[model samples]
Target: MVADKSPKAGVQSVERTFELLEIIASVGGSAALGVLAEHSDLPLPTIHRLLRTLSAMGYVRQLPNKHYALGPKLIRLGESAARLIGSWSQQHLRELVERTGESANMAVMDSDMAVYVAQVPSPHSMRMFTEVGRRVHLHSTGVGKALLMQLPNDAISALVSRTGLPAATENTLTTPDALLRDIDLSRGRGYAVDEGEQEIGVRCFAVPVPDAPTLTAISISGPAARVTLKSATKVAPLLKRIAREVASEFDEHAAG
Candidate 1:
């Protein structure tokens, strides 16, 4: 087949291919060709052609059930991207730690969970420690809530239903309605709090990174004694500012 030489056509083809890949990822990393066609609003022949090209390039694979899954080759790309983003945000997270006197973290939503990508610990001995790459439930962590609050209510309901809202601690929200209420409160207040929700005696405050390319959040956490409600009130503005700065830098890098 002759390749289309028109620039506009080439760009559209690239966009459609990526849109198909995103659809597969959004549907749990695997989907039937018909499903991809329906979701992408593209014809079956076009979907099949794109998937064939992607599979030939080792960017996607055919599953035993005849569905297509993201290929192993993409893992390296994802890890590298995560590391770059984490590196870019480290200074901001360190500044957050200095301002809040707590462990500062950056996380992005992965599948149905919030995955920590970077962190900077507080100076105090009794600081919080959420290891990078740790995945937490959306209803039990400040960063999780911050990311979740960006989703529509119906999407949140579907995710809560899929994950079943299992309790991580006594304070964890175990129902969709309760979690939704908290999400609303977080949106209204411009930040989210995990007050002994993920772990007893620990508290966390988080704000979503403004205009982030992905569903990213930044947070500060520590022993409940130190990250008190009053302290969170004082730190929220700082966290938001850092989030904005990080987002700006990220956008600039992506553009460049």
Candidate 2:
């Protein structure tokens, strides 16, 4: 028989293409050819070939400054993907809202910030409300911190340096050291909290969606008067459990 050419041969190339795309995204959506080579640990020639193909496919663009950036075509795909995630998240948010008597929200990382994609408002008139599509800093909000929890310390530091950790309230962590400490505590507790950081009188509890298709988080927010420290202890476990369920359902749907 002649030399065989299996689809497996193509799979490796496809995987490499996606890997390069991820590397570009990881480095803030733009990378010089040398930077790409260094980060990917792939040969310059391989990077060039893959980037060329991606450029032709309109998934990557070569900048005037000789860096490669995520192309405009990706925005459409990303928006569509976010919409799907938001749709799937609605029922989970509803459950959290019903059980916790607070507004339940789902957010995903976007443009280096966490943006709300779905929300189920509380029945009570006094509940907190963060509109869907509102972008909040990763250092100043419960859902934002939860979204960042899984990233490496180096990545988190880099993100903070880029975003500058602007304070939204007196309680917001404005230093990397403080934010890291808070992240450590959040990790230990298996949840994150926003105590008047995003909004005065509002307290939020959030958990990262484990094994999610994207960096995603879900949260419940209410008046700080109603959502006390004692109640946070009770709400955190439920937030974590529901987050896992949301991730499971999302991953199942993605695989199918």
Candidate 3:
């Protein structure tokens, strides 16, 4: 109980509590207590006590089958964090739009989907339109592939098995093998390309935000006629540069 009153003890307890929550999240956001005990450094009793406290606080919930998952309260926190990150990245996305002459957007993986967090539309009359907060499948968008590239093949396979790679357009890669191969190609080129996968006559190019807080990606998208192969080759560098600036902005935000 001294841990509740001592500053140092309280800090350690908070750290351990968050570490356990992260472990639960890392294993897909639900796990048995024994599974958590195996992954954590804390003893079983400490883990149990922390979980009990968290459950009571509504930050973690125990299922009928005895597994624990992140609770609804964390959803409110996650949504607020996403909005903050989105606001911080907007200026960089605007720079990307200016440099590339295309719409620029930022997305982060939310659960099994990629959700657009920020966007700066192209000045041109014909441009891609992705509303902020719109969730899209991981196999059908440029940001999706860039986000998925952060994960291992096995993790992606497990995810694809669950989501089943629903096709958005004829260009969409609907099979796990195809999506993996495309991601591999994207890795070679250091970016992902939509090539009209999300919508006909639209093309998108995306690169992951390095050292980002989450599986985050920034992209430039526009009509395929305007975003041709030669244009895409040139715009990729600008996207990457903007991504670096965005990462620096996030660092500053965290430090402050």
Candidate 4:
């Protein structure tokens, strides 16, 4: 018998390399060769060769435990990608602000927190504003809940265990059970709400960006006086629509 090699072997090799990288990222950015091979369904020798090439290119590193991990070079690439994603979503956020008469925000899940990536403030004088790059606990904010609810229940449990649900305001959910209930509600209703949870008298409505390459959400927030529960009913649809638009933009960019 002769070993068979396909014409598209080079393309397959490239795809397998990216699959390994994605597996490492999914496993918190580090895993042993056996683990990578198990997840990738590729031969151990092939995985080793790819890892060696990736390591030489500074895209992966061998840790003390002999596990391959995402390398520091990925940090620069990730930051640049994040910035571009944020920039691309700004117009959609601005549209959200215009439609809802509230501040609109885009956020992505980073570890155990939700990091604000972009914002478009309401034209009103009394609008809400969260600084770009501000990281907030995932258990309390609207965007946080929106991103969290997209994960599996076990992953959600693990994350909540790591980052305990601390009270951001008196109305914040301070227990895992309560937060989980809210997550369920968000998943059921197609959106999440922060009713004075992150800040007293501030309300927010958030929807996850569907089909996004990463865990991302878009939200609209303002004072309770203006952004009431009724306002949430009105804004949720807009948020969801805009989120889908943002996700489509992401898909297009990824394809390009």
Error of 1 at 225 (Å): 0.6
Could you tally the backbone clashes for each prediction? Answer: 0, 0, 0, 0
TM for every model, in the order presented, reads 0.91, 0.92, 0.92, 0.86
* lDDT values for all models: 0.89, 0.89, 0.89, 0.88
| Model 1: how far residue 188 lies from native, Å | 1.1
Question: Which of the two candidates, 3 or 4, achieves a greater TM-score against the reference?
Answer: 3
Model 3 per-residue lDDT tens digits across residues 1-256: 2335543445768998998988887777888988898888689899989999999999999999999999989989988998999999888888887887889999998878999988989999888988888999988999999998888899999888878988788999998899999999999889999989999899899999999978899999998888887886688888888889989988898778
Q: What ranges in model 2 sit over 4 Å off?
A: 1-10
Q: What TM-score number comes out for model 3?
A: 0.92
Which segments of model 1 are wrong by more than 4 Å? 1-10
Candidate 4 lDDT, 95-120, residue by residue in tens: 98778888999999765788898999
lDDT of 2 by residue, 41-144 (tens): 98999999999988998999999999999998898998888888999888888999888899999999975899898999999988888788788899999999
RMSD of each: 3.1, 2.5, 3.2, 3.6
**How does candidate 2 fare on TM-score?**
0.92
**How big is the positional error of residue 145 in model 4, measured in Å on the Cα after superposition?**
1.1
**RMSD after Cα superposition, model 3:** 3.2
